[model samples]
Target chain A: MDIIVTELTKSFAGHIVLDRFSAAFPEGEITCVMGPSGGGKTTFLHILMGLMSPDSGTIKGVPSRKSAVFQEDRLCESFSALTNVRMVLDKSFDCGEIQAHLDEIGLGKDRTKPVGEYSGGMKRRVALVRAVLADSRILFLDEPLKGLDDQTKGHVIDYLKKHFNERTVIMVTHDKEEVDAFDARLVTLG
Target chain B: MISTMFRKSRLEKAGAVFLALAIWQIGALLLDRSIILVTPVAVAQRLFTLLPESDFTHAIAFSFFRIVGGYFLALLVGSVLAVGAGHYHGLEMILWPYIHAIKSVPVASFIILCLIWLSSDSLSVFIAFLMVLPIVYTNMLQGIKSTDEKLLEMAEVFRMSRLRKLKYIHLPHLKPYLLSACSVSIGLSWKAGIAAEVIGIPDGSIGEKLYEAKVYLSSADLFAWTAVIVLISVVFEKLFLRGLKMFFDRLERS
Candidate 1:
């Protein structure tokens, strides 16, 4: 089912973050949300993910199972990249299957090292892979590729395109090329 | 470069210890009173003699088990209580006054008070537990409270299980705090535990030996027993911390 946001309103200390904002994210497609900084793009995503509640609004059709690549990589620092991804999966999943996906995203060589030792761009890709592989009906990406260089960014965008599957993906970003790369519908918020 | 620096530090430490020993030897010679302060050589001789005695082995075993047992008990109970209080603010509030009392009360008062309720034999165990409990509880609670909120939110969104959340998030964050707590508390437990034993004068305990040395005015025996306590404390701390670190390393790898 598609998620529908109706007149969503949120404020922090009387400053409005989201003011009667309405949007619809169709199921099984990528919808990129874009706006200037501090424009409540992240707040909107947080509300839809149930991390925050809108002051006055109604949202419908949000699935119970959801996953996210937060603004921060949020990877367990001491754990390896493979362990970080494996944590969200059930026992039935094999490590070999996870390693194959990590290989596709160029993290195969460093899967054994702790994520604490990873570079910022490498950490971001690990977080992205974790989100994609999690058992979820929807995936939220908040500045998922923020720290990547242009070269790595292109490669990761390809990986996302190949792996995102049919889940509803709602990403917040400032880059227009990323939007065009996915041919994703854009929603502006400010 | 790091290995070279480490070697230099080791040499400096050895030099410092030698200088201190020289000063001690000079002071002992000038005083020329074995009753007041014995020479290090005399104390070393006394320790070697005591090492062969069955009573010495028995005393060491008696004190070692009680003090170390108390420390392990505190570690287990403190971590469990801290995790419980971390999840429930009401529970924390309820436990506040008791933790406060334990922290504020003098060790001597607790020892005397516990003597009325507990046998002298188990006094060191209880005392050690009392000394270490608050340290572990407070540090673990601080670690739990200070866990990164962003990672928790990510876990929630991913529908992660409680066991997974603990393994991936809570345990890793708590490692440093737990290590620090253990280091500080281990030494404190031994000091307090031995003090309790001395007051109670439990049979077959290191504390009983110390008290006997005091009564008999054997400074060499006194110094020897003190050195034994220090050696045991240091060895225990090193072994426990190394084991804990290995556990964390294995956890991260697996």
Candidate 2:
């Protein structure tokens, strides 16, 4: 089912952030929410992820099983990228298949090292891999390519589009090119 | 390669011991009073002389069991209580006053009170457990509280099982706290445990030997027993912590 946001309102200490905002995210499509810094884009995503509650609003049709690549990599620092990805996979998910996907994202060679030693872009890739590997009906990407260089970002975007074609994806980003690269329908927020 | 590694480590340890002995010898000479400060040589000689006696072994065993038993018991109970309190704030609130009281009360007062209610044989274990519970509880609770909420959120989203969450996230975060608690509390348990034993003077215990030494004015025996306690405490701490680290390492690899 497609997610529907109706009259979403949120505030922090009497400061309005998202005021009666409404939008709809269709299933099996990539939707990008773009805005200026401090424009409640992240707050909206946080509310969607159930990390926070809106003071007044209604969100409907969001999948119960969700995965996310948060703004921070949030990878387990002491675990390997392989281990991090494997942690979210079901028992039926094959290890060799996951390794092949990691290799496609340029993390195959460093699969054994702890994520703590990974570069920023590498860690981001690990987080992306973990999100994609999880068995979620919907995926959230919050500035998922923030730390990646242009070359890696292009490769990851291609991988994401190809693999997540049938899953609903809601992405929050400040970059216009990212919306273009993912072929996402743009939803602008003030 | 294995033999060479062992040899190198042995040499390094010996060097450290020699350096420490030199410092102690210099300090003892500066103090210049055997009553106030005994030299390493004197303590070693006293220990060597006491080694042959069966009573020495009996005393060591007696105190070692009680103190170590108390430490292990505290570890079990404290970890359970920490998990309980972590999961339920109401339980934490109820336990707050009792934990605070234990922390504030003096060890001597507790010992004296315990003497009235309990036999001297188990006094050391009770005291050691009391002293260690608060430390383990506080550290583990803080560790549990400070666990990465983001990871927990991820686990929830992915519908990870409780066993998986514990194995991957909770246990890893708790490792440092548990190790730190063990390092700090092992010595405390021994110190407080031995003190309780001395006050209670349970038969066939190190505390009894220490009290006997004090009554007879055998300063050498006293120093020797003190050294034995230090050695046992340090060795147990090192061994226990190493085992814990190895367990975690195995978990990580598997």
Best by DockQ: 1
**Which pairs clash in model 1?**
none
Expressed as tens digits, the lDDT of each residue in B46-156 for candidate 1 is 999999999998999999999999999999999999999999999889989989999999999999998999999999999999999999999999999999999999888
A1-112 per-residue lDDT for model 2 (tens digits)? 9899999999999999998999999999999999989989989998998888999989999998899999888787888888888888887889998899899999999998
CAPRI classification of candidate 2:
medium
Per-model TM-score, in order, reads 0.97, 0.91
> Candidate 2 at B18: error in angstroms?
4.2
DockQ of each: 0.90, 0.50
Q: Classify candidate 1 by CAPRI docking class.
A: high
Error of 1 at B134 (Å): 0.9
- Please tell me which predicted candidate would have the highest TM-score against the true structure: 1
Once fitted onto the true fold, the runs of candidate 2 whose alpha carbons sit more than 4 angstroms away are B1-42
lDDT at residue A43 of model 1 (Cα atoms) = 95
